[model samples]
Target chain A: MSRQALAELFSRCRAENRAALLPYMTAGLPDPEGSVRLFVAMAEAGADGFEVGIPYADPLMDGPVIQAAGDRALAAGSGVEVALDILEQVVAETGRPSVVMTYVNPVLRMGPEVFAQRLSQAGASGAIIADLPVDEALPFASALDRHGMGLVLFVAPTTTEARLENVVQASPPFVYGVAELGVTGERDMASSHIGSLVARVRKHSEVPVVAGVGIATPDQARSAAAAADGVIVGSALVRRVMEADTVDAAEDALRVAVGELADAIRRD
Target chain B: MRLDRPDNQGRFAEYGGQFAPETLMPALEELETEFAKAWDDPGFHNELNKLLADFVGRPTPVYRAERLSDQLGIDLYLKREDLAHTGAHKINNTMGQALLTKRMGKNRVIAETGAGQHGVATATACALLGQECVVYMGEKDIERQALNVQRMRMLGTEVRPVTSGAGTLKDAVSAAMRDWVATVDTTHYIIGSVVGPHPFPWMVRELQKVIGEELQEQMDGSQRPHPDVIVACVGGGSNAMGIFYPYVGSDVRLVGVEAAGYGLETGEHGASLVAGSPGVIHGSMTYLLQDVQGQILEAHSISAGLDYPGVGPEHAYFKDRQLVEYTSITDEEAVEAVNLLASVEGIIPALETAHALAWIAKEADSLRGQTVALNLSGRGDKDVQQIIDLVDADE
Candidate 1:
């Protein structure tokens, strides 16, 4: 259901002549109920899709802000099951395709087939395993295929030509192009070189190319969406949600913030 | 006996794959290619052997521990890795990797440290080769191994302290890996174990295999026939791999002793092989001390070196194949073994090595007719301060 829902989403956005605006959230962060509230507001504010994060003990690719959020989520006892639950709630309420962003260990522990089955049952459109390298993504990729779900793979500026081709070929639903060379953090703008990377990805992939990691502002999202099919905003909205004092405050801040980002993404 | 492993994908049985981010995959592939080429080149081996003999004082003497043997009613031989320069077998891997770094045209090196032995050794290698070195050590380890921290800095290497995840060896490894991911083009990550992704586990083992090679030749020359048993302590299991590689298919029995901390039954131990389930940590799938939810549990041990939650993937393979007997020793038992070795043989072993000594002591009476070989992996000078505190408290 989510596989076709995700494809329909991209096509619908394409027909509307605007790029999709995807927002990311670390599940159970700040507080469980607060995270749910924030996600609901993001959906209402015009997020085209969602990428719900599952916290791990060690998140090597995340910067200080996201790492702190993950710490908070883990402290709240929001294990993998809770993250899945949050994804289900987000998809149910919003009726938009959602993906779970997680590291590979948790997926490996749950057994790929079981994890895939549960995520598909929960209505997740796809998953982005931040650390599952191309060489090791095969078994999990196959499992996701059986459940008719997507496995979003990453391509960086430093990714070699041969490896980039492999990533483009293997990835489904969309290709997540890292906007900069560093780990995920809130930067003033995306890397200027992302246009060339998106072009390189475009040569091999017909699926939408979604740029992420370091896209922080409306201007950055606008510029990023100009070169790619869409933009996935993570740290920017997450940072706002993190700074808000309460659930209501977080939802309010996220509502206004997501509206700006969504409007900006539609410009190109 | 000849040893072969890591079938093309760098896996030892079901363990050991490159489970890294996409950005790091190319670098790992590059390393794998370089290592394979270098290992085949005679020139590389020539340079490495030269350093091992002249600089590291390789072919370290194997001495008969007659006094301890008499006390235990067994014939015991100790491979004197304690006499190696920088005071442990760690230099062997560092030296080899430093040479590889130069060959790869990488002028900068980064490493993760636990007990600080690998750090001191890596710093020494970089200083010798004129390569810029950075070592990440757990904050708690930097506190416990103060002398080694000073030694690393004094050798002109930058020591970065890691404050994540129980502040121990596992955290240090995670930090080093993150650094490598961002700086992969100019830096060679000198992983200080036989437990990391691909090429590293195989590379470190091949470099450290000199220990088992020399042991084989030395034992052949000695009056005592082939030893019935061999033992070494395992943290990331480098030294054990070093001594066990050359004897893979032989008749000799091999044992790896892990730090049990308080006790394995109490669940405050680093004996992953004995008490852990299979899980991935630090890029390789291996036996890990993880909870039911797959969250890696912090390990505990008096020995900073062996206080880790994971073991080398090859060791896991060995354990499954029944090729190696994996066991554990508690902190109290290891400390007692340290005192016994000092009093009987006048050689103070590092707390890590004392774990193996404790195992030997326990099984000595049963193997009275057979000869046992143990790798005294390091000298206890670096550990003297910590041991002194423990002893004084006991008094």
Candidate 2:
């Protein structure tokens, strides 16, 4: 999808009074087929967007749930290429918007230009390279722009205003505001300074700002949606998949969580 | 003068090369120019020498190991690097680099530590210079060397325990490198040894040459023209290179001993030179103990200082060029050497440096009438309690 397409999608989510349900799933967790089916199922179950995680040996900013999923995916011999292929199949099946979530090394290894081109060809809407800072985002951003793909940047609570402005200016689509200092997990969102963070980011950028990182419960998602244009829940969806008794159970649980979160955010 | 030669490709004897990310190319180039100019400036050398003597307590004695030499049937002269302040030859490089950081107008220093010797040395320099210091140590190392961690903290250094990937020295170095790349504007990564991309190995060597320089001066003054052999342990090979570089042109045969935790054949060892193949690791071309698929393997050694999977690039170059003969000493042998030195010489050498002394003891009979000088790299006070525990366990 083009940057314009992603922007329109974000605007539509805002207009419809619904928080964006961005479900995250490791590429080959459970198995490759199960991962693809889960992706399609989540999309069909009303996920506005999906974050397809590429397994790596070291996931610095990930908690135990995501880390274990990544470990299982890696043990199944899944890598960036595998993740992209699975994403291609999911998009082909459901025509849902998706973002590739990965670290910088794999992208660097794949060559930024080629990676962007492949993602664009495979119908991936955008990407969020977790480790790439705003100061070093130009090359990757330019590559994504070259392929008509969006580069989503993360704005943490600790991020300085100057850095946030730089990230907003460099990145396309929208800025993802990390609501807390810790990694992704089903964290207690009551203490998250989500409102002020979204307000600060809104003051600096004309681009849409979505808040993530600990929006676990439907109540938390609704609360986050009240202050931001979008609420991206990842760790909760990943946790559901991990705790599922079977692949079908995982898909069913993810659909139920997304439907409930989407309904809760839309209600108000 | 062929002053531009070493800078041609960031090399020291065709081993050290700038195998770093393109982002660091500019910084490496800048460091190379500054270090080159600093090396020729007599003022810089004089100031460094003064600090080494007054502050760091240099010209650390050359004691004759009379009892051990008599027992082994050879004359052993110990170049006492252990007497240096902060307890290891690591300080020689840190102090020089810290001063260079000041000269370059940088106020923050970052360093990576394995056994925390370098952390202590860097912390000492930062405290002395009043510069803000940050040290990255693996969580495992922080636990193993808690006292050294506390020592670093006492010296006012911020010690960050890295919990990434195996959480060892290699990962710590990786984290430090990442930090340097991100914060290169005000930070000078005082790489703890003769490693890293470029200019670092050469710069560290230039600083550590004091070891060999003093040994030469002291040896000449004592009527011993030169040693028949010079021995030192190799971890990242800083101490060994520090004592061997000045004697390169001389006929003194250099012997580098590595940690053979169990034995070389058991594959449970840190004898990188003997068991490793030349591969690119941590930015420089070096001998690394990697598996069949090129994954860097975890090293095992009783001596924390000697427990690295890769040796310095300079040591790789030396080994390949046949300038130094590499050997291994078992943990059992090193422990015995520590006990022997404490009993005979009344000096306890660091577990790391004891590897060299152990090798010398084992090979002393072959060099019967020859005078061999060993780099007593650090005091064993840090390892005393650990040794006591090991002894008690053995009993």
Candidate 3:
């Protein structure tokens, strides 16, 4: 059911002639209620899909903003179950396709089979696990597939053309193309390297390839959407929530920001 | 044992693999290919062996500690790795990896350090090989190992202090991994211990096998050729694996001593193999000191080098297969062992090595009739200040 939901989401994006507006949300960022509240606002403001981050203890790939958000989430006593609960609540409210983003350790600790089962039960369309390269990702991918959830894989700027097939062969819902060379953070338009990486990924896979890691503003999102099927904005959205004074302020800020991104990604 | 492990997928019975970001997957592949080519090449071996012998001072003797032996009523043989260049067994791996960095055509080297011995050795090797070197150390480790920090700086290497997640060895490893994720194209991360992603645990162990290999050659002339037992400290288990890998299936019993900081009950120790459960850390699945939610716990020890939450994957394999007996010693006991070795033989052992000596000292009476070989992995000159403070506190 969840895998079908994800496929339907991509179909919807194509029919609407707009790139998927997948806004990354860190679950339980100051608190669980606030995280859900903000996601509800993002969904209302035209977020086509959601990437829900389950805060981890050590987020090596994440920059300072997402790292701080995760740190606060963990400090508030949120674990895998709590994050899954948040996912359930978001899906219930939004009724939109959403994927859980996590580092591999938490899923491994939860036991991959049980982890996949729980996420599927929580109504997660798929999962994006950071730090799990395709070399060691087969078992986890199979586990998710067995549970009827899409497994998202990454194709970084550093990934060469020769190595593109193995990742594409996995047939992820979307190939997460890391636009930048460094950890996840905001970057300027001075370096727009997403197109080349997206082009390389498209050579092997027909599925929509979404560029992430370096994108921030609506302008960057539109420019990135021009090169790829979609864009995943993480640190930029996270910084807004982290720097906000109250829940209302954060929700309003996210609603406006996601709305701008959605407008910018509209191809027609 | 036959000792062919990590398989092709880099797993040692479900432990160890490329648990890194996609950015470094190609880099790991490149490294594995280059490392295999270098391993099979005689020219690579010729250069590395020459550097090991002349630059890093290899083939350090196995000195029989007569006085300590008399006290223990056992023939105690110390593999004097303290005599090696840079005052620890770390130089062996550093020289080999530095050469690999050159062989791979990467001119930059990045590493993480705890006691800073590996940092100093890496800096020295990079200086010799004309490779730019950078070392990530925990903020707390930088404070404790001040002398080693200065030594790294003096060797013309940049020592970056990591402040995240308890500011210790585990954090330093994460910081270095993050750096490698960004700059992997021109940079070859020289992981200090046998604890990182695949090829590392295998590569480091292969490079360091000289310790056990030399012991095999040196003890051949003795009446009891192979010692009844071999002991080495297990901070990430490089030194222990170095000496133990050769004797995996041999009659010689292998024991790895870990640092049990305040004690197991206090929940403050670096005894990952002894007290930890299996989890992923620093790009490899291994025994880790992590909470139920897989959040890494802060590991404590007076010895900065041993203050880590994860052990090498091979050590985890040995633990599961019952190939080696893993034990722990408290900081107080390790300090006493340091004083004991300095007083008995006038040899100051590093706090990391003292953990092994402390274990051997405690078990000496039980193994009275046998020969025990302990890898004295490092000297204590770098730890003199902390020792003085500890002794003064005792007085």
Candidate 4:
């Protein structure tokens, strides 16, 4: 059911001849109440779907912006349960298919089956474990599948073609293709290597490929959108939310960034 | 005893596995393949043995601590890893890994340090081999281990200070792993302990098992060549694993001592084996100090080397199997043990090593007349300033 919902969203975007604009926000970040408000506002501002980040202590793959935001969410008493609660609300209230993004440790600690069951119960579409390798995706993938939710896998520019075939074989709702070599952060432009990575991913599976990391500006997002099926905007919007002094102002700034990114991916 | 470990997927009976990011998977796989080939290659062993003898001054002596043994009423033998180059058993693994780095055609190595012994050792090996060396240390550790920082710089290493998460070993590990993710092609992350993902725990243990092999050979003619008890300090559990691996199926008792900062009751300690729950940290599923919500809590210890929040996953497996018994020693007691060993045996032990000595001191009455081999893991020359401050406070 959840996989179908995500697939329909992707199909709808393809029919419209635009890449899906998936805006990411750390769940319960800054504060639980404010984060929910921001998620709702971004949804209204034309975000095609939501990628709600479940804050973890050691976010090795995150840059300063997302890490700081995650720290704030954790400090504000947002544990795994709270993050799931917020994820449920974002999907329910915004009426958009939402995916929970987190490191693998939390899921492992929570018991993968239980965690998957909770996500399914929470109305989440799927999950993207940033640190879980495709080879080690068995128990996790099987558990999520039992709940009719997808486990998204990653394909990096550094990924070898042989490994790319293995990753695509897992059959995720989409492949998360990293745009650059480093962690998640905004850059002035996307790496040209992403186009080749997406093309390589296409050779193995028919799954939609979404490129993320280092995409900040709308032009960068537009370029990333051209290479893949969709583009994920995270750090750029997260930084705007963090830099704003007031919660209201943070919400406004996030909505504006989402609007421009959504517009960038849209076909004229 | 024929010990079967780390099944096909690197799981040490559901404990150890490669629990890292997607990007690092290929590198880890490559490392595993290379390590397996190197282990089977006699030429690789010959080169590593030559380095161990010439560069690291291996075959480290086991001294009978007569005075301390008499005082404690036990036949105590000290495996003097302190005598090794870079002042610890850490050099053993570093030398082996550095050679592997060369074999892999990687010219740069990245490492993380807490007390800086591993950093110094890694820097030394990289210098000898002409490889670029970068060491990541937590900012707080940089303040405490300043002298080692200078030593590292003098030896042509770049010490990058990490200011994240409690500013300690766990954070340094996180930073090093992040660096590896970005530079996996040109750099090999020389993890400083028997921790992290699959091949690391297995590779480091195999590299360090030389300590046990030597001790067994040295005691070949002794009445009690097989000791009744083998004790060592556990920080990511490298030294303990090294010393304990050879005697696994024997009648020998393996004991690991963790640091209890104030007391176990006070909840400010690095005694993960004693008080921690099972969780994943720094790549492997292990015992770690984590809250109910799975956020890793900061572990505190006066000894910087033992102040990490997690223990190696293999140690966790042993603890669960009743193969090894783990306990804790407080800071005050460990400090006294340091002073006692220095005065009685004329040997200053690293604070991390002192914890093992401290445990023997407490258990002397019950362990009377039994042969106890304690791993004196490192020398305390680098711990002079920290010891001075403690002594000053005492006076």
Candidate 5:
């Protein structure tokens, strides 16, 4: 998928008075079929986009909830190929855009060219290489672009203005603004200076900016959406899925959370 | 006689192999080639020897422990590596690898440190070589060894505190390895000990052989050409191997001592050589203290130097060949030896080295008529304040 396609999806979410959105969940978490069902359910519940996490042995940026989910996925013998297969099933069921979120090791292990080809063939909308800095991303970025897949770049709160500009220049899709200095989690969002951060990133790029990392409640989602074009909620949604007594309970909790967030963003 | 028997596939007696990710295969292969060439290069040896003598303050003293020996009724000698620059034997290996990294054209040095000794050593070399240095340390270690953290910062090295996986040495190593894999082009990971994948154990052991080599020359000049027994503490076993390698075929009995923590039978210990079973961890098949399901268990020791779950593959080889006898010393014994040596010999020993001292004290009666050489691997200067504080706390 092209940058234009992602922008179009964001536009539709905004036109519908909803948050231009993405929800992240580790693939094969709990179980393969259940995780796939949740992904399809989230898309059906009006999630504009999805980030399918390829579980890793060391997910350095993840919080306890996501880490536990990833551990469950890995223990179940889930890998990048398994994650892609699940994504394929979700895409076939929901027909919504999905991106593969992973650290650079698995991609490097699979070979960049092969990874790009496999992602494109699996119908993934884009790829987010979390640990690949712009200085070291040329090879992977070029391969993704060659395979007609968008390479989403993460701009952290600690990133300098010069580095932010470099990231904007290197990014193929929307710039993902990490909401904090640390990993993903359900943190108190009262002190987040996301509005100023979004403004700074907006000055550097023409692309949409999506705020993520520690966004949990509908209030935080609305606050993030007020500043940026999109709000990405990961750890909170992952926690709900993991803590739910059953798959149906998980889907219900996710639908209610997404609905509340959608309404909060749509409010004038 | 060669102790390292690389199989046809280049394994070290079922212990060593290239277990790194495929992304590092080419680089590892390149390192293997460069190392083979450098091992044979007279110029490389000359440079390393010069650096060892000038930079590292090598030929570290072979001081006879008069007071301690007199008390135990035995002749005792100490290999004073504590006097080496940077306060330990760790710098010897770091300087060698940093020089090799420079020769390989790598512009940066990255390493994982346990007790911060290795971090300081690597940072010192990086500062001298004008290479960018980043040291990964566990968060827990940074808090415990705050002085070393400041030392690294003062040396202009970036010290990254890894907060993952219980925040200890093992996690620090995992993080460093991941960083090395990602930044292979511009980075060289200087492994702190004789652990990790192939080439590290071989490289570190070769660099550290100076301890044994110097001991040989020093003994030759003295009345006794060789001691009846050689004792050294084994963490990852570099220091022990350094003092033991040259005497492998000799009549000198080699003894490796490991930390017993509370006690070896309590399952709360770092005695990999004594209480551990054979297993694979961090790319080497060595004796590891692992759980029933094969997961590596966290090791416990009052001394950070001994807090490792597995030993180096070379030590494993020696143990299997029965060339060396491995044993354990309890925390109480180690502490007693520390105080005993300090009061009797005017030399404070590192807690890790105290394990060897403790073992020597126990076996002193049996070995009374014979001379024994002990590797005082590092001075207790870095550990002195902590030891005093602990003693006072107990009192």
Candidate 6:
């Protein structure tokens, strides 16, 4: 049911001939309740969907912006339960397809079936487990499948054609294309290699491919969006929320920041 | 190879799978292929063995601890890895990996260090091999292990201090992973222990298996051959794995000692094998010190090298299969063993090595009349300052 909602949103974006603007936020950032408000504001600001990050002590894939946010959220007692609460609220209030981004350990710690059941219960569309590659995702993907949820897999420019075919065969909710060879952070421009990687993904399946990592500015988002079906702007937006002194300040900034990104990727 | 691999996907009986990000999967696969090819190649063997002999001082003597052994009514033999070029067993792995890096056509090297022994060894290899090298060390370790830190820098390597998450070994591992993700094209991360994602645990053990191979050759023909038990300290467990690999299926007992810090009771210990549950850390499934919510807890030890929250996945496999015995030694006991070794044997040992000695001392009663071999993984010079500070505190 949750994956169906995300599929419909993707179809709508495709019909409009525009890339969907999917913004990411670390759950329980300032606090649990405040993060729900932040997601609500982002949805109101025209984000097509949300990717809520679960706080983990060790985020090897994240840069400073998201790392600091995760550390703060964890310190604020944002464990899986708290993040799920925030995910449930964001999905209920925003009425958009949302997912959780986490490392592999927490899911394994909770046991995949239980974790997936709780994620679905929280109204999540799917999950993007950063360290969980397709090769080691059998149990997790099957567990998520039982809950009618999708497992999103990543494809980097470094990924070979044969491996990309294998990833597409997993039939993820959507394919996450890593924009560059680095952790999640803002870059001056969209990575040049993303276009080829998106093209590779397009050849295998009709599944929507989203470009993420280091996409900060409107033009960068537009370029990344051009290469794929959607663009995921995380660190750029996360940096705003991180630097804001108050939730009110962050909400207003996100409204404007997400608006510019939406406008840049939106078709008439 | 006496040390078996973790299947095709790198899972060693539910432990030691490649749980890294998607980007690193190809690199891991590539490394696995390269490592196998290198291992099979006679040229690679000749070069590695030659360097092991000429530069790093191969076949470090296995000396009998006559005085200490007589005190306990047991024969204690020490595999003096301390006598190696870098003053630790770490060189055995680094020299091999640095050469492997060159063969892979990667000119840059990155590594993470705990007590700085691995960093010094890695840096020395990169310097000798003419590769650009960088090492991430915990800020806490850099403070505690100042001398080895200086040696690493003097070897012309960049020493980056990781201040995140207690600024210890695990955090340093995370920092090194972050760097490798971006620089993987031209660089190779020389993980310092039998940890991390696959090819690493298997490959490091293979490189270090030389210790066991040498021991078998030296002792198998002698009258005083076939020890009743073998003991070594385990952090990420390379040194222990090194000396324990050959005698795995034999009747001889294999024991790995961990640091108990203040004591397991105080919850300030690094005894992951005994105290931790199965979980993933540094990209592989292993026994880890974590809260129920899955947040990693800080591991404490007087020895900087053993101050880690996780043990090697291979060690986890061994523990589960009952192929080896896992034990712990407290900080107080380790200190006492250090004093005992210095007084009785005139051989100052690394704090990491003291854990194994302390275990022997504790089990002296049971081990009486039995012959035991312990891998003295490193010398005490790097830890002498810390020991001196402790003595001064007592004074």
Chain A only: TM-score per candidate: 0.97, 0.95, 0.96, 0.98, 0.95, 0.98
The sequence of per-residue lDDT tens digits that candidate 4 reaches over residues A79-162 is 799999998888889889889999887887798999999999999889998878787788998999999999999988778788
**Candidate 6's residue-wise lDDT over A1-268, tens digit each?**
3888989999999989899999989999888878889999999999999999998888989988888899999888898889989999889888999989998888988999999999999999999999988999889999988898899999987787878999999999999999989799988766897789888888888888998888899999888777688899998888898889999999999999999999988754
How do the residues B92-187 of candidate 3 rate in per-residue lDDT, one tens digit apiece? Answer: 999999999987889999999999999999999999988999999999999888999999999999999998878888888888888988899899
User: Model 5 off-target regions past 4 Å?
Assistant: A1-268, B1-5
First chain of model 2: TM-score? 0.95
| Leading candidate by lDDT | 6
After TM-score superposition, the amount by which residue B134's alpha carbon in candidate 5 deviates from its true location, in angstroms, is 1.0
Error of 2 at A85 (Å): 10
> For every model shown, what is its TM-score relative to the native structure?
0.96, 0.68, 0.97, 0.98, 0.67, 0.98
Q: Model 3's lDDT to the true fold?
A: 0.88
Q: Note each model's CA RMSD in angstroms.
A: 1.8, 7.4, 1.6, 1.5, 10.6, 1.3
RMSD of 1: 1.8
Taking the tens digit of each residue's C-alpha lDDT, what string does model 4 give over B173-227? Answer: 9889988887898999999999998899999999988998988887665644567
Model 3, which residues run further than 4 Å from truth? B223-225, B391-395
Of candidates 4 and 3, the better by DockQ? 3
Candidate 4, which segments miss by more than 4 Å at Cα? B1-5, B223-225, B393-395
Please report, in order, the local distance difference test score of every candidate based on alpha carbons.
0.88, 0.80, 0.88, 0.89, 0.80, 0.91
In model 3, pairs of residues that clash are none
Using DockQ as the yardstick, the better of models 5 and 6 is 6
Query: Residue B110's C-alpha lDDT in candidate 1?
Result: 97
TM-score of chain A of 1: 0.97
Estimate, for each residue in A129-158, the C-alpha lDDT of model 3 and write its tens digit. 888888878888998899888789988878
Error (Å) of candidate 4 at residue B162 is 0.7
> How many steric clashes between backbone atoms does each model show?
0, 0, 0, 0, 0, 0
Candidate 2 off by > 4 Å: A1-268, B1-7, B11-15, B19-25
**What CAPRI-style quality would you assign to candidate 1?**
medium
Q: Compute the interface RMSD for each candidate structure.
A: 1.3, 8.4, 1.1, 1.3, 10.6, 0.8
Better candidate number, 1 or 4, judged by TM-score: 4
lDDT, model 3, position B364? 80
